[model samples]
Target chain A: MATIKEVAELAGVTPTTVSNVLRDRGRVGTATRERVLNAVAAKGYRPNLNARALVERRAPTLALMLGCITNPFYPEFTLQTNNAARRHGRFLLVCNTDYEPDGGSGFLAEVAGSLSDGVLVANTGSLQVDELKSIQATGTPVVISVWEFPDVDPGIPCVAFDSHKAGYIATDHLLDLGHSRIGALVGSEKNGIHGGRYKGFCDALRARKVKHLKTDARFGTDSYQGGFDAALDLLTSTPDLTAIFVSNDLPALGALNAAASLGFNVPEDLSIVGITNIELTSQSRPALTTVAIPTAEMAEKSVDLLIKLASNDPDAPAMVRTADPVLIKRASTAAPKSRATK
Target chain B: MATIKEVAELAGVTPTTVSNVLRDRGRVGTATRERVLNAVAAKGYRPNLNARALVERRAPTLALMLGCITNPFYPEFTLQTNNAARRHGRFLLVCNTDYEPDGGSGFLAEVAGSLSDGVLVANTGSLQVDELKSIQATGTPVVISVWEFPDVDPGIPCVAFDSHKAGYIATDHLLDLGHSRIGALVGSEKNGIHGGRYKGFCDALRARKVKHLKTDARFGTDSYQGGFDAALDLLTSTPDLTAIFVSNDLPALGALNAAASLGFNVPEDLSIVGITNIELTSQSRPALTTVAIPTAEMAEKSVDLLIKLASNDPDAPAMVRTADPVLIKRASTAAPKSRATK
Candidate 1:
């Protein structure tokens, strides 16, 4: 409740000296600085941040917009980004878009209008290219995470992982186990990542010279329900399938549940592999065998890139930080039975 | 970006009229408003949000601060709160505290200076009652979620669930299943919710005339690894235990995995029940039989309460929203084997 004038008077310093102390800049003697700090602490004087932002044209805060909060994947990214930001003494303002295209745009617009020094857009599958471009033009440096825009040039720094490679690695692991008949429980292909994963799955099958069954492909929601429904459909349609590759860990978990409900033993009747290798994947019934994407590493690197961009460094290139998709073979995957192959 | 004057001149309206149209306020003619809107759209005029906020002395943004972004529980809460905020056409800013006592206070101070219209403080176990009161004194309406202050009343609103009842329900379910030797895998007692749940667990055992063994208690992180370690310790120390009630689903999941790795059959050997039946719980190997807390509903209602409190509504009481914790009986829990009793 104490005012800046009161602190200045108590410290025997001018209001300008008090302001300089708060900003941690300008020429001031060490004794004077100590006296100003002590007086400010004694009086409990809080700086007026809005007025300061208006004068300085900087908020010292960054905005991180995520597609969905319930997905657990975004949180992994946020956790790392937040820590990195804090290390640089910056604040991160997070917002969840809920995977709505209009909502993503709306949130981006709001972030542009706020006191954020920069914006970190992550997994905004629903946002159109034009909307992204317009937001980028708002003078706020943006770092896009996980997903990439084809039209976005090197000017827009992007932090992405190889989703296509992730899909291939997971499927290849299952196939290497001598499981020939494989089904893919994928998310909606309307988004780029899901589409990329689907493409990779097809490419892997074609490369292996296996009979690629169109009926084996099942599309569902981006959630567990989607995975559950897709698994049910795939199982009912292709009863001979020996392995299944899901697009993400969430759906993979759903598949695990659906498989259990259907009285099918995992790895024994049907092998399952997923991407993202979320925390729950390890804790699940049969620990999920997944393609581990380095979410935290990606987040940390993206913040560094964005910080460089915000500092007006032109040398900072659009970084695509892709981690090697390591196959975490667990109890969920195994070799196909000779009797089932025939 | 075109200035307000340019748009106003082109639209044949005064700058004040243009400002009113931009703010969606004042009694302006429909035709004039349309013309201003068209000119603004054609010229690509963006109202300087910083300037507007400076004039209004309000940021027109709400901030939600959590313990950590990696915790999926916070994200789940954020998703629902965001949906509600979006419906009301308000922007949300999220910040993560990382559950550090000093760091949490620093984040709160930073948020307090950010000029947010309101704040929703979901403290991790790190925050004390006095720190929360100090934050509330900033005149910014705060809605405390997950944790409750014991003594301080800063005229701020709060939204909390009955964690004790949740604990009681989970423990009672295991007891009702004829499991006498129950081990409790709880979070640190320093955490408000964990303490409440622990008390409830003790009270349930007392009501059932069962001897609650203090040696069966273990304290550690609120993660899967923590649960795994705790379960391992408890199992070794209390070999006669037939059931375990975990504080949260994440740790409960770890316990499940530890049980499997230790060659113990769930239900037949060791029955388990967890709180916060998160999405991963139901999707786990045996499908976790736990208590389901209405996280999304609580998030929505919390934001609604905060909004009301911010509007200076005297009708808003110091409310605590209690959602019924439903017993989701799954394969994880069953009657103990006759051999265990013998």
Candidate 2:
């Protein structure tokens, strides 16, 4: 209800000085700044960010396009990204693309350059690379973050971690427990979104000269129920398995419950490991063993890179590599009971 | 990168006509509208939302201040709110105020009537009512959504739900199943955020003439770990208790796992009932039985109320009440074993 003119009149300063004081731009004396702030408080004058954004040719927020917020992983990623954006005095406009009919094409078209200054695509697996490239072409900086494979470039500025290594670490943890008869439950197809992790699982088996039959692996949807059904089918058909390596944690949690329902005692009858140690991993029964990826680092770096790109910084690199994933040995894994007893 | 002028020139129409077509306002011939849309697509012109907002004196976004985005409940609430806001052609600016020292006072000050046209306060329990009133006084519509106690108004526009009824139904379910030794786990103090639910629980016991003691109730934080710790303590202290009434779903989940860790089989050794049937309730082992709150309805009503208030509609009611909570019976609750055997 209060205007800048009233605040300026009360503070005994020009409107430009009030603007500078509010925006924290230009050199105003400390006393002048305090007076202006006090006047603003007294009048309850709120700055119009939309007008400022128009004059500055920059929006005050960055858009984060995520597949699904309720999936648990995106919430963690969204929180970190929200905090990182806040540190820069910017807000995060989160767009859930899972419910979109065109897989967010319409959302990207309307939001790429208007509602937000930059766009951060958190779910690159489902979104097309060409769609991201087209958005980048519109001069609204676009950054693909949490990209699974470091080797595969989307031809856009992105932050990537070693997915292959993440898979390798989770599988190696299972192997270290002398689990010769192993099974694999991949959330995605053999060469779909989780290809790198599945590849890493195979390499871990090959490195130890362990034979993996065609029936030893199952590929299905990348979700908890997917993991549950796949694990149920795999365990029922191959009851001799001592360990199972799951590509993602959500499905692995489902598999854990599925295993329990099937009368299998975890860490005694079977050992299971998962990638990406989300918060729920620690809360589940037996405390899932998993590989902890650099979720926070990736989110922070993605925001940093998007800001740089939006500012037209030529020094912004095409790819930002984060720390490698490491194994967190929780209670869900142990040596095979037959070998332990022997 | 293209401007409206270029699109107008290509469409053989004035810039004003182009604007009318793009905004779906005023009158334009169907053939002319198609031509303008074709030109817009061909030229890749993006209407600046900030400029449009400045001209209309209404920002194209709404600010949603939530306690934490990482909390599973917030994500579900946020997704529904986002979809509802989208239907109104507005974007959502989510602010996670859990990390803030003042619990979002600063967020409210900067975001209200500036970056966003209206503000939706999702977590009213922890926020100060006076702070909300101050924002409302500034000519910005502020809606307090998901208010637990419908009887107590915060002197602002809000959407209310029957928390007392939710608690009563959950307690009644247990009482009907022949469980007399029921312990209560409150996610807050006796008169804190969950007070309404606790009261319902007490009233339910009194109506049935079932004796309850101060030692039978434990008050603590509203989270999984909070529920876990309290349940562990309660179960250890009162091993004869055959059922538990939890104030919220998240804490109830933690209590369920805690019971498992203590070697108590759910529904067989103890029946547990929680308010709020969140998605995880069905996903958890034994599929927790809970009272289903009208989450989606509340979110939609809150957004609708905020929009109406922003438009200065005189007929907008002070309070909007959603549908009542209902019981969702699942594997987690059953009659006491002693009664079942008889």
Candidate 3:
């Protein structure tokens, strides 16, 4: 119920100063801006929307699409992306593409006309990139995250994690543990970004002169159940393997569960490592050892790119930005026990 | 990039039928509506926003504010809400209130002018209801979730889980296992909605004629670390307790970790139960025993109410809709063993 005049009075500033601060128009000193913001918060002042629209033309709104919102990795990604987008002065419109046939193409078709100034698309499942293109075709800018465009349309910019290096590092860590027979839980989807990790795993084996055994790997969905089944199969079918590199943490946790069910203690009998160290990884039973994707970095860069593209000419170099990954050591990983222990 | 004409052509219907189906207008048969929707998806048809805006006086958009987007309990809620809103012909705009200084008051200040037709507020922290009131004062309808409108304004409708029942059930389960000496980890915020659970826990204990121990409960932020620290403190200070009821699942997982580090075994030495059956509970060290709230149902009803309110009168009965909770028996809970067995 507080007015601009009351906020101005509380901050000891003129009403014009308060108005200017609210509109982000006039050059206000940092201290004065902070004071005005504090007073606004204390008074719980909301500017009249109609008046705001007249003052601030073209409401700057951006839509963010998470193709698989159910994936544990996305909630954090969305939190960071939403925060970053807000910091850049854009109100975010989030859409969950889960359960949508053709990876949200239907919803996009339904609402694409009213979408904000730009769109940020995350989790570019196989069917998503084209849907994004259709959105862009509607004259809105689109920023793709967590995947390569794979096409030379130069239609949109993208920001993604370095999954290839993630795979290499996880393999290196297991190799350093003095394990020659290592298994991997390859992603169920052949087109998944996790395939980068599989590639890296294969290269690391080649570099270390460790023979790659195709039979030592199992492929399934990127779910805990899939990981559980894959790990169970890998451990049972390839009994000599001492360490396992999982595609992502969800499956890694599943693999750990499989190890437990099979009477094999983690780190003591088998070493497991995963990628995308989601929040759950740190709190999992044994606390999974995994590769941590720089999701926040990707989020910020993608939002920045989309915002920049929205403001400038349509042809603002549609570049791709990549963020590095980190290795987090937790209890699930340790030097494998003596070869005889297996 | 498929056109409305293309969808109509594919579905063997006139473009008006396709348009009517898209806009949820006119008397369209169910079978015809499905055929048009299928054609729309197959053709990837996106309606033109400017044309639709000119056709319909109101721009049917709904804004959903999540006061705590990082709570692990919200992603699924958001997904369900977004889908339901879409089904009601409303585009959902989501905002995360986590990092906002005034619990989303600041963000509301900036975009309050450009927000959608109606507002759906969830997981409201302290400063939110007033902000919602301020928003409603803009002649906008607002639907609150998970909190009482602390004021006498009779402000808006709310849909919340039956937390009291959850608390009572979790406690009664533990008591059924003959756990006379039980501890609890309550949420830190005195005004938090989770307080309902604490009240229920007490009522159940009192009903069983068990004297409540004030010192047996610890309060902390609803997070894993908070639960861990509180449970650790409780275990170190009150070692005789055989059961613990945590207000939320994140903290319950933390409590499990605390018991493990304290050299006590779960289900055998101690039992722990948590609320908000998050996905991690099933995958936790010992899958967590939890009170499963009907989040999807709450989401469906809240969105339905919000859309209806947006279309109907704002004063159309500010009803409180509460969904029931279910108990999920997981590995983290079990009857305590006799000292003789150990």
Candidate 4:
């Protein structure tokens, strides 16, 4: 509970001298520095972090605003961001918005009020541009991850994967396997990625001359349970469908389970593909053939960009780095059976 | 970047008066308060958070320390903890330790030097007691989650699940199903939960008069690959074993897949049970029968306890709260076939 003034008084030096010694900045005589250090130790002094942040004009911390921690995808992102933050000698404060609108707004407010040097905002599909702008208005540099707002001012940087391309690749793969009737197990349309991926799917089908591509699109929760429910509904509604493209790995896993329980053999009677090749997908039975986004790379690059912005270098170009998604073909995808080929 | 003095001058008040208004403490005339608020709005003055934290003598944020975010279990815990923290008007800063000997000590130093009110530490499996003590000495109240240091001072509160009981329940259930030649697929011995669970399994076998209890334990990474390797080793060492109890769900799933690939039928030829009943367990090929911990409840209660301690309540008792593990009997466990049953 010792104050900087108290430490200064004990060291027989001005507060500025004590501050400089603590920060390892501005020169202080060796003897004076030793006296300050001894006084600090003697008084059990803890540096006043808030006062230090004000003097340095930097919080030396970053905020990572995630959509939901439970979403498996985020842990990888968190690890990468933390590692990158450490490389720059900065700390990260994580906030989970839980995909709730109110929670997202409240979190934005709290983080904007905190002394965070920058923010890496990973939208959970629901972002209000105005809300984001207000936070940026506080002079905290922000790097948007996963989801991007098209209308965001050029000043805001974004690091994302090409969800539309991912969707196109997944669907095109199924089409190449000679399956004409494919179903889409898309997530909630409220999600920006979901919408983009769905649009991509539609575009691929249209370009392939596959008329009346029976769409079994349904909106459900963004979870395995939601995927299970959606799969069941899709199968019941479009029993002739031979292949399915899910929005994410979790739901794709759920679809696989649903197929098994319904007595359909994976890759023989039905084919499934998912996005975000999470670790579980590789470990899953009949390993998922999905698009693997470079989660670590995205996090690392986002942090690097945020740090550059925080350094107050106006010449740093505003960037939108998009890593291409790699299609990992595993045991889950195979040629459609002859009976369903036409 | 208007300073507090500038805002005060605009509001025609002393800097101290403006600070009090910002803190929402001390009596101020209603008209003066409105004037200060209007000045803050007009000048777009954002209070320096570090200065505010210093003045308040408490940072309105909590730190969450975990082993690794890549582990699905930690994210689930984080989700619940974040929700609970939000309900109590607090923010969380999550840090990963990667289960090293340093055990998040480096992260703790950064947090201790930041605007954090308290810390919730978990999964410091390899860290010695003294290392944790050093963190506590920094004057931040810490609530150890998921792991318990029995030798440490009892005054340090901990929220832990009874791993031994969970082990006993899982192994005992397999025993009651008439499986005698049970093999244990435990985690690294360095992990307290792994050791505790192994001990409990051993005790259960002794009580049941079960012989040839193959303890094919392995020390490796705490991950699915580790479990898969352990399972392969266990199968090679004890080909006659009828059932297995894994320390965690991820590894249990890995073991299940390994058994399947080895052409062993689940529950018919071998039964598998795991702890932490994670989401993947239920979604696995054959839903895993495992022990379920009340993660959200534990997080909520721990935060409640920390809030009380932070309020400077001398009467608050240091306590250990345990949540009972429930046996979620699923399709993964059953009586071994007559040929395998002893």
lDDT string for model 4 (A129-229, tens) is 66677777777788786653333343467776677788888888988888788888877673545876777778888899875444567755368988888
Q: What is the lDDT of residue B87 in candidate 1?
A: 72
| DockQ, structure candidate 4 | 0.58
lDDT of 4 by residue, B131-245 (tens): 5566567667777766533334434667766777888899899988988888777776645557777777888888988764335555553589888888888887778888988
Encode model 2's per-residue lDDT on B1-342: one tens digit a residue: 889999999999999999999888999999999999999999988888888888888888898999898878999999999999988888888889998767778877888857898999999655789989988888889999889989988798999999999999999999999999999999889998899999999999999999888898999748999999999999999999999999999999999999998999998999999988888898898899999999999999999999999899999999999999999999999999999999
Clashing pairs in 2: none
Backbone clashes in model 4, listed as residue pairs:
A50-B50
Task: Give per-residue lDDT, candidate 2, residue A21.
Answer: 94
**Order by TM-score, highest first:** 2, 1, 4, 3
What are the TM values for chain B, all candidates?
Answer: 0.88, 0.97, 0.83, 0.84
The residue-by-residue lDDT of candidate 1 on A43-109, one tens digit each, is 8778877777668776767888877777778787778888888887677777777644576776777
DockQ, in order, for the candidates? 0.56, 0.79, 0.39, 0.58
Which residue runs does candidate 1 get wrong by more than 4 Å?
Answer: A2-36, A99-101, A148-156, A202-211, A319-323, A339-342, B6-40, B99-101, B148-156, B190-192, B219-221, B314-316, B337-342
Query: Over 4 Å off in model 4, which ranges?
Result: A1-47, A99-101, A148-155, A190-192, A212-214, A219-221, A339-342, B1-47, B99-103, B148-155, B212-216, B219-221, B339-342
**Model 3: TM-score for chain B:** 0.83
Model 3 TM-score, 2 decimals: 0.86
- Residues A1-342 of candidate 3 have per-residue lDDT tens digits of 678999999999998999889878888999999999999889977665434432443335777777666678888888888888878877777777766655677666554454466777886664456667767776677888665323334355777566778889999999987888899887754445667778888899899999977788777648888899888888888877889988888888899989998988888889999998798888776888998888888888888888777777665556655657788988987777884455
lDDT of 2 by residue, A1-342 (tens): 888999999999999999999888999999999999999999988888888887888888999999989999999999999989988888899998888778888888788867889999999755788888988887889999888889988799999999999988887887778988999999888998889999999999899888888798999747989989999999999999999999999999998988998999998999999999999999888899999999999999999999999899999999999999999999999999999999
Provide the DockQ value for model 3: 0.39
The CAPRI category of model 4 is: medium
